[model samples]
Structure formats: C-alpha cells, structure tokens
Target chain A: MRALDVDYMLGLLPILLGYVPLTLFMAVVGMAFALVLAALMAVERVVRIPVLDIFVRLFISFFRGTPLLVQLFLFYFGLPQMLSFLTTINGVTATIMGLTLHFSAYMAESIRAAILGVDRAQWEASLAVGMTQAQMMRRIILPQAARVAAPTLVNYFIDMVKSTSLAFTLGVTELMGAAQKEAAGSFLYFEAFLVVATIYWIMVEALSFGQRRLETFLNKAHAR
Target chain B: MISVQNLNKSFGATPVLQDISLDIQPGERVVVIGPSGTGKSTLLRCLNFLDTPDSGKITIGDLSVDAAHASRADILGLRRRTGFVFQNYALFANKTARQNITEALVTVKGMSRADADARADTILRETGLEARADAYPASLSGGQQQRVGIGRAMALDAELLLFDEPTSALDPEWVGEVLDLMRKLAESRQTMLIVTHEMQFAREIADRILFMDDGRIAEEGPPADLLDTPRDPRTRAFLRRVG
Candidate 1:
C-alpha cells in the first residue's frame, strides 16, 4: 500500500552489512572443512574398501537425502539431548557443523566423478615410471581431478553463502537475522527483504566473477 | 639384459599372452610385430608389470620378479628397470614436457629437483622437444607428444625401453617423426623392445624380430630372416596383412 521507503532501506543497509562477516566466516570455514571431508569420502568411494566404504556411502546418503534446515535443528537441538558434549556447542558451532556435513555429502560425489574422469592412461603411465601409489596421486592424479572439479566446487561455495541465511533460525544473528529484526521493528517488510535479497545477489555475482577467472586459469593447460 | 619366462595372461577365459617367453641381451633392440589383439603389446606391458600377467617371471638388470608371487617392492623394482612408451603418449596432462621427464627422476629416483631439471633438459634436447619443454600435452601435436614420451623414458636411463605401438596413435605424417626418434635410440644401442605395425622401422631397428600370434611367439629371428623368409604360416599371413 505504501511507496517503498528509501530512507529505511538505506539505514538498514549498514546494520545488515555488519553481519556479512559472520555469514562469510561461517561459509568459508564450513567450505574448508567440507572440502577435506569430501575428498576423503570421494577417495573412499573410489577405492571401495570393505566396511569403511559402506559407512561412507550411508553417511553421504543420510546427509544428502535430508533437508538442510532439519539437519541444522538436529545438530543444535536433537543431538544436544543425547550427547552431553554437544550440549555445550553454541548456535554458531551447530550451524557450521551442519553446513560442513551437508555440503560434504554433495561435493563428495563431484570430487569422486572428477577423480574417475581422468584417463586410465594417466594411471598406467604414472605406475609404468615406478611411482609409488601415494607419489602418483600427490603429483599426478589429484591435480588433474581438481581441475575437473573446480567449477562444481565453486557452485557449492556460492550455494553455501546463501545457505548461511538459514543460520538465523538456529539463533545466530547473521545477515538474515539482522534483516529480520530491522523489518520487524520498522514494519517495512518489503524494503528490508529487497535490500537483504540485493545483498545476497551482489555476493553471489562476485563469486561468479571469481569462478569465471578460476575456470580460465584452470583450463589454460587443457586449451588446444 | 632383460628376460621374461613363462609369461601368462588372460582377460577372463580368453588368453592374451600364453606361456610367452623371450630374452634380450644388453644393447639389444628386439621388436615385436604381430596382428592386433595377438598380445604383442601385452607382452611388452607384462615386462613392466603393467596389465599384471597372470603368471610370469621377469628379470631386468639386477631385479627379478615372478608374477604369481611378486611383492609390491618387486613390481616397483621391475618397473624401475624398464621404461614404457605408450601408444597414445600418456604424458601427464598437468605437467609441462620438462616436468613430465623430471617427475620420476624426483619422485622415484629421489634426485634433487635441480638435478632432475638438468637431466630433463638433456633428454628434451635428445628427443628434439627442448623447444616445447614448457608445453602441456594438450597443446603439443601427437608426434611431439610421443617424442616427449620417449624423452621421459630416455631420462630414466632404464635397462630396457618398452614401446607399445608408440607411433600407431599418431597421424600418418606424424608417424615418421616418432619412427625417426626410435631409429636414433636404436642407433645409440639402447636395449629396447618395441611392438609396432611399421615393418620397415622394425626391420631397421630390431636385433631380433619376434612374431606373436594366438598369444604365442610363433617365430623369431633376425630382422632380415623373419621379414624376408617364411618361418611360420601365421607370421607370413600377419606380415602380408600389415606390411
């Protein structure tokens, strides 16, 4: 009914911007842990060791099959009731744990596919030269796999930045939390939501620009 | 010297290399010529434990391993003594031409990076790939890539070189360049075993020629004798088809 409030949107911008660091911090830390976990999961999938392999498959399925929101609640609320140590974890820690586990399940498959996509000849050639399996993987296989997985991995990171918005539901005041409080008090839902959405748009676009640069850099050797 | 005795391999029930045996003296260049799928390539691959022979014994230089009971160390030792040149020039896609040669030198041989680079430079110069030392495999022409493959092998200074149709994957025009490099290696008296369809190159380079058929060595002799005279009907038929 009322025209969009420019003054309120401008005032809300700085307050919301203050929480951007928390959002970014959670995403970056979550992504770093997720990448390491995903790599281990991917290798386990590829090697298919007996018991551990089955466990990894189930872990991926459970995390990937469930909704991220429910997973966050389980970490923050459900696990605390059963596990005494988990009860000490704050809302922020719970959100990060949830993000890491959820994204790892998705990214593990991408990393595994990239690892498998490398030509079999590369494996043969590395072994033919007397390289130990570890040496070959460190020097040869993983670098090529990283190149193949780069674009997909970046998309996950971008999705992760947006995913951090869900952190507010866990009682941590990230960007979305700040936007919610400002809209509630001022009763300017439309203006506050638009500004918050715009902030996310800008953040994602910046990531996309970085992704394009990364893709070009990674693809330099492959270009004929 | 390199020797393989009682080499046996199979893909499921179909035998790929059946009781295959051969010996090459130091500085000997033995070329394997045969029809496709007859296991000429399989024989060369078995020497390095690539393709994992169902059973066999291979002795190269100071290392000896029996396929049936080979340990990880034994396979690694056997692979160290033999260099393999693949048909498709499987140079590392991530490394430069120079790094491709230097990788094993640093990792397997435990040489310093500085020392490996020096050796890689010499190998690149020998294979005429010094100009493209920084080029990735995707950017190089097939012939140039194969040349780098040869250079990588040459850098190892292994007791024997195994070539599995090194030029077969190249374009017709590019084939000559790879063959020419092999000729140069032969002239230097490198102990080499090559499997190829190029009869003329085989004749020019082999100290002894081996003709494989039905996963067995049907006949073997000096280049002129095997290529010119008929020892076995299968060998003759194979030569007639490919030659």
Candidate 2:
C-alpha cells in the first residue's frame, strides 16, 4: 500500500542472502541422509523381509500421509516429550531430522518402484554370467535403477530445498526466517516476502536447468 | 561337459521339466526343438539352476550339484560352468557392448580391469560388434543387441553355453543375424545347448536334436533321424504342424 520500499528491500537483500549457507547446509545434509535411508527402506520393501517390511510400509505411509509442517512439529515438540535425548537437539537438528524422514518416505517408494521397473531379463543375464547376487545389484540392477530414478530423485531434492523454508517455523534463521524478521522490522511485508520468493524462484530455476541437462545426458544412449 | 540325470522341476503341482536325463560331451552341439510351454526352455534354464530343478543330479566337467540340496557354492559353480543366452537379448542397458562382454570376466572370474578390457576387445571383434563396442543396448538394434548378448556369453568361455530361445524375441529381420552368429559359434565347437524354434537352423547345426513333449524329452537323435523319420507319433505330429 505504501509506495514500494526499494531501498528497504535492497538493504534487506544481503541479510537474507547471509542465511543462504544455513539453508543450503540443512538441504544438503538432509538429502544425503534421506537418500541413504530411502535406499535401505526401498531394499526392505523389495525383498519384503519378515517383520521389517510391515514397519517400513507403515513408516512410509505415516510420513507420506502427514504434512511436512506437522512432522516437523512432532519431531521438535512432540518427540522430545517422550524421549529425553531428543530434548538436547536444537531447532536446526530437529528441522534436518524432520526433512530427512519426511522426504525419504516419498523417495523410498519412488526408489523401490524404480528398482522393480528394471527388466527381469537383466537378473537372468547377470546370474547366467555367474554374478553373485550382490554383483548383480551393483553392476547391473542398481545402476539401471538409478538412471530410472534420477529425474524423480532430482525433483525431490529441489522440493526438499524449498521445504527447507519451513525450518523458519522451528526457529532456525534461514532465508525465510531472515525475511520474516526483516518484514517485522520494516513493516514492508510485501517487498520482504517478494525478494525471498524471487530468490527461491531463481534457486529452483537453476536446479531445473541442471536437471534438464542431466536428463538429456542420461537419455542420450536410450534416445532413438 | 555337462550331464543331467532325473532332473525334474514343477511349478507348484504342475510339472514343467519331468524326468529329464541328458549328456553333452565337450564340443558337442545339442539343439532342443518343441512347441511352446513344453519345457524346452525350462530344460536349458534348469541346467544352470535358474529355474531351480526339483530333483536331479547335474555334473559339469569335474563339478557336480544335486538339484534338491545344492549349496551356495554348488549353485555358483553350476552358474560359473554354464552361460545362458536369453530369448530376450537382456544386455545390461546401462553397459556398452564392450562392458557387457567384460562384466562377467571381471566380476565372476576376478580378472583385472585391464585384462577384462582386453578380453572384451577380443569378444567384440569376434561377434562383429567392434564398431559398436561403446554402444549401449538401448541404442542397438535387436540383432546388434543379441550379438552383444552372444558376445557376453562368449567372453565367459564357460564349458557349456545354453541358449533359451535366443531369437524368439527378435524381429523377423533381426533373426537371421543372430542365427548366423550362432552358426559361426557352432563351427568353433563351443559346446552349446540351444532351444530354438528355427527348425531349418536346428537341422544345420545340431549334432543331436531333442524333441521335447509334455515336460519330457520324448525323442532325440541325430538331426537326420529325428527330422526325416521321427520315431514318436507326437514328434511326427509336432514336426508336421511346424513344417
């Protein structure tokens, strides 16, 4: 309503950008943990090993069915009530823990489906060549599965980066947190939020560009 | 180099391979021909324990495994001794034609990467795919893919090569190239057990042609005896239908 505060937003830009490292750090660490945990969960689902299969299925369903915000609250506020050790974890730890578990649920299903999508003939071919089960996975199945899973994995990573914005609610001073403070101080909510949104937009656009190049390179051999 | 005695396999109550007994000497080429679902493919798959036979004794070179009680080592030995070519080319889509050839040489045989690479070069040239050595299966034609599949099997140099309907999945135009490659391999006497529907090709390369029917080898003999004058009425009926 008041004439757009260009000077105010310009002053706020560096402050918002200053928190970029924390935001990226959360995203990077969360992704690494989620990818590994998702892979393990996917393996259990594929092999369906006894009692663990049921637990993994339920875990995936619970995380996927719940909102990321609610899951974050549960990790930060709810879980610590029951488990004493969780009380020592700061807001950043809780946010990372929440992001890892929440995104990994979705990732695990996609990963499992990708693994299953590989042609059965590949398994036979590997075995016929005297590959141990582990070799068949390492040399043949997983590599193919990883290619199939790539685009989806990249999509989730981008989404996870955006979801890092939610960490502001948990009291972590990420980009969104810095903007929230800047908006509170300047009373220029529109301009403050606008810059943060644009920064996120630029960030995602860069990721999308990278994803396109990766997909093209991966598709080269399969392209007819 | 491989012998199977009383090898039986069943899919839950329905028997797929029933009382199959056979012997293949080194350098022999045995071709099995029969109608679909009659266990011709199953016989080849069971030989490598891919289908996991119900009851049998399999002896390959000096290593032997019992169907019902094979240990991990026994099954691995069985797989190591025999190479299988699938109805589908089944080349690793992620691997190039050359890597397809080298994968087993390095993984199963424990050759160094350099040695495996060298072996891959030889196989690629032998299969006439030297020009396409770096090509992946997805980019290759059905014929080229099968050539890589054969090359992959060849690189292993197993005592026995088992082909389970190798050309059955190929396009009509692609079948001839694969058959030609197989004929070439046969000439080199690689000791093969091939299950094929290509009767004419069977007659040409077969030292022994097995006529399988109702989950059993109903009749078998040299190609001339089986093709010209089949002893069993079922064999005659089958050949008449296919011919």
State which candidate has the highest lDDT. 1
Model 1 chain A worst lDDT window (10 residues) = A133-142
Residue lDDT tens for model 1, B126-196: 88888999999999999999999999999899999999999888999899989999999999999999888
TM-score for all models, in order of appearance: 0.96, 0.94
Show pairs that collide, candidate 2. Answer: none
For the second chain, the TM-scores of the candidates in order are 0.98, 0.98
The single-chain TM-score for chain B of candidate 2 is 0.98
Predicted complex 1: DockQ: 0.79
Candidate 2 runs further than 4 Å off:
A78-87
Candidate 2: tens digits of C-alpha lDDT, residues B167-194? 9888999999899999999999999999
Give the CAPRI rating of model 1.
Answer: medium
Collision count of model 2: 0
User: Each candidate's chain A: what TM-score?
Assistant: 0.97, 0.94
**How much is the lDDT of residue B126 in candidate 1?**
85
